[model samples]
Target: MEYDYHCTVCRGHLRIGNKLVFSAKTRDNKYGLIFLSPELGDYTTEHHPDFDIQEGEEYLFYCPICHARLNHTENEKLVRIFMVDEKGAEYEIFFSGIAGEKCTYRMRDKEKEELGPDSEKYRQYFDLPDEYRKYL
Candidate 1:
């Protein structure tokens, strides 16, 4: 679903595609949802040391326009992230930490490694954006 919107922070025109789910554990041990590009595939699952997150908590999904963090809410059992662009248009997307049956091993391993602080790449993985970052 393409959205005609504007950035709430920068007031820039925002064109967003379909709602893609990116799941990770939050610092508070809660499941978090991040909206990102569907084309992103399993790229966010890659192990990086900079991104640190705990399962099942809230976190910011950076706005592409203003680079500010977007607000998250639980919508119909799915975690949804909401953002308004410069044009006052609102966009919402959903996600979950639990993987579907079709999920790939590469994506699962990447998420596991990122969530495991003992993993050598944990620190580096925490640095990535919430949509791409892994949680322990």
Candidate 2:
């Protein structure tokens, strides 16, 4: 089934079949979208490039609207994004990043993780073991 993404903070529609996109950042501070936040602006401009990955690095995804970090946790691999399946079951989409723009869906939990660790404490903050496979 198809899944939909939204900003946990603002409840803003993020992903709905090419409608909106989400923002992502690498440890080195590069930024891109798993999808576009909107159709009007180009986030991957000359001034900014997609994340450059190296051995043993972490990446992050966040809400472009609130600028709130989505994939920040003690466990560096798993990044959670608020998602709702087509059936209307809400879930936390755990995307595990391996390298630059290369990642996999590690898990999909109806039990949500903290979308914001420092500022917005989720019901249960992600603290899983950092032992993800190369690609899901």
Candidate 3:
């Protein structure tokens, strides 16, 4: 399944080839370009060796196009982006920004789909409202 990723702020295309590139700032203030797999549930990442990222460390992500911060308002540990399928239906995509954390959520309307082993770690933030839960 192919999906296109975009920056939520500027709606700029983020998927380049097989990677979604973003500007990242480490907790210690180190900055670098981070390449992440476009595949949902795939946590593989590529970056310069000099741009060291430590596991369990939270990093700030930004859009390379508009340079807008991608951190989700509900949870800073997760980065928000827009994902459009071939049908042109757009959905909100949220993924972990903490190194080595594998959690992702794809949400549309009041529906949601979780992907990754650590997805439950942030499940509470993505849960539908009590009124909507009855329909689920």
Instruction: Name the candidate that leads on TM-score.
Output: 3
Structural similarity to truth (TM-score) of each candidate: 0.28, 0.52, 0.92
lDDT of 3 by residue, 49-124 (tens): 9999899999999999999999876568889999999999999999999999998999899689999999998787
lDDT of 2 by residue, 1-136 (tens): 4557767678777765655565767766777765543222222211133344444456576787887776645445655566676688776555444333323232344333332222222223333333542222
Residue 22 alpha-carbon offset, candidate 2, angstroms: 2.5
Q: Which ten residues in a row have the lowest lDDT in candidate 3?
A: 127-136
How would you encode candidate 1's per-residue C-alpha lDDT over 1-136 as one tens digit per residue? Answer: 2334344455454343554333344445544444444431232433134445444334544455565443333211233344444465554433333222112111221342221222232244334666654332
Candidate closer to the true structure by TM-score (higher is better), 1 or 3: 3
Off by over 4 Å in 1: 1-47, 72-91, 94-136
Against the unseen true structure, what C-alpha lDDT does each candidate score? 0.37, 0.50, 0.90
Ranked candidates, highest TM-score first: 3, 2, 1
The total number of steric clashes, by the backbone 3 Å criterion, in model 2 comes to: 1
The residue ranges of model 3 lying beyond 4 angstroms of the native Cα positions read: 128-136
